[model samples]
Target: MKKTLLILIFLSCIVMANNLPELGDYSSSKISENEEIFIGRQILFQVNQSDSIIRDIEISDYLDLLGKRLINASTDPAKKIEFFIVNDSSINAFAMLGGVIGVHSGLFLASNTESELASVISHEIAHINQKHISRFLAQQERASYQSTFLMAVALLLARSNPQLASTTMAGASAGSVQGALDFTRENEKEADRVGIQTLNNAGFDVRGARDFFTTLKKANQFSGGAAPAFLQTHPITSNRISDIEDRLKDYPYKQRLGNQTFHYVKGKLKALLGDKSNTKNILEENIKNKIYINEAGERFALAYIYLMDNEFTKSQEQIQWLFDNEQSNPMLSQLYINYLIKTNKVTEAKKLYIQNLNFFPI
Candidate 1:
């Protein structure tokens, strides 16, 4: 069939990549490391200039540390990683050139544990580690003549390589491109395959990947057949779930302790975004009934919600709970400062802020 041939032609160059020993290399690419870095810089510049990027210091710092931890366990331990959280509520995350990974805030809220979140980061790292950059760029030039194939390639790479995607979409038919979108499921699968191993190496529970996929699948059912933004970008098929389950079988079953910071970050998003009343009730009930990820994080969320509601006394009570055990949390420190300033404690807030400069200097 015409469709089948087009898929084969477009993927011919990348097909043999499956049997390779290395996860592709910079030496074989026409785009040099410097060129890739420059491209990444431009893309990040565009992203930063956009209003959608979260400029929160606490969230950004946590993401940077979490991503770097996984990168240290990667095949290229010394590889530099830049991670950012977008302000969008959509469930999406992407990796691009120059070791850049951007995660949407909704994805952070959707993640249940540190390992689930790390699985997503690990998958993106694999995309860069596997050098989909060079292969995608090369495919763009080679497959340009066929409009449908080119469109499929661009759409497949849209989340990972948007600049190329924009250019490719301009000349192709949107109506026709859907047939060829499956061009890169192999690439996605490979990312998953490579990601879990790195995830395990990084000492995370690989089951987080499997559970996250199940979450996506369940979210899809109530989506009116439209799918989440994440599902659109990272298409999860039944086969992919089976593949993950099989890969998971290779690892011994053991629980990985969730990080307190991870729980705090998740709780932070819950309090700040979505339904405030619903989030407040959830946080309060979870804390009172002892049904929370980390009780400290739950109290932190309740404190944040109380602060936003101008319930300073109640907020301080929650902060005191966290203070009893964790007096050095960055997110809590910021929240406490905000609460202090709101209650006419500027002198004290400024003093505390100055004191934290040495430790929480982000």
Candidate 2:
């Protein structure tokens, strides 16, 4: 029975390997674009089956918009990209095959501005644009099948049982795994270099990348525990920060203002992930202490919490304050419309929508 089971597994592996697109030319040390897309689709199918993805429409729409902005600025603007927000709270983002990008919810909580978050997206998109994953697979000449299978398995296991995957990888020859890590590190550096240019070209504050790394480093130090998954994968060093800074020196220094939508998304994520009471308390405390640079975000958080809690009266009051203060803020306008619809005030919602369309005829 054991022998038969083993044979079945082996045959299945062979079948899977055969179904994959032909490996890129070994002599050229490259995987063909079609093969890369096929591998990416397979990996994405596995990822979806793991049930680790967050399916919030608002968050998904925001990430897609942000990702496409960066992709548009990349060398390969025409490449199709898909973005997902993972349910995990660990501060991490990764790019998989076929222009797929995953962002952890904790990353939203950790980021201070839209540009900070965009920096991470830009980095992941750069990895995809550069074909780092496919290149890495192409480099595994001897155990390509086993390595590819293990990689997919590792990704599926990462969210649920990372230790198991780590142990499995540790069983491999140290030299081989270490060489892969070294290559990944080199990829990280190249992604950073390319990502910074993409961020700048997309009209985001370039300093956001450096600022985010600095913040992550500080958080890692003060936590007195394991580094966040982002650092574990991206490996932030002082030299890395310095390299980003040096690149920044080439451009004229300009501070880009934070968008209202950035804070709105952050608040919405916090409300969705955190307990209502705790979120409310935290937002109140931040408002009381003036912790945030913009007081508007605190109000937005309260509004979002109220909206989630079905406290339409409170939600409307908070959103109204935001609209009164920032008349041009589209996010606030949308939220208010949502509130009106929820309260069965369709007439009001329709009138507001028409007014907005007239004012901003895109």
For this target, which candidate reaches the highest TM-score against the unseen true structure? 2
Error of 1 at 247 (Å): 1.8
- Model 2 clashes, total count: 0
Global lDDT of each candidate? 0.70, 0.71
Give the range of the ten consecutive residues with the poorest summed lDDT in model 2: 1-10
Q: Which residue pairs come into collision in candidate 2? A: none
Per-residue lDDT tens digits for candidate 2, residues 125-144, read 88888888666666665444
Q: Tell me model 1's lDDT, rounded to 2 decimals.
A: 0.70
Local accuracy of candidate 1 as per-residue lDDT tens digits, 1-362: 02232234224413322232342343334556765575555445545555556777777888988888889888778887677776656566887666678787878877878888889899989988888655665444332223322332334345533333344444444334333233278878998989899899989999999988777767668666656666666667889889899999999999766678887887787787778989898888887788965788788888999999998889999898888887477677888899989999999999999988878775
Q: Which stretches of candidate 1 lie over 4 Å from their true place?
A: 1-29, 142-157, 160-183, 275-278, 281-295, 325-328, 350-362
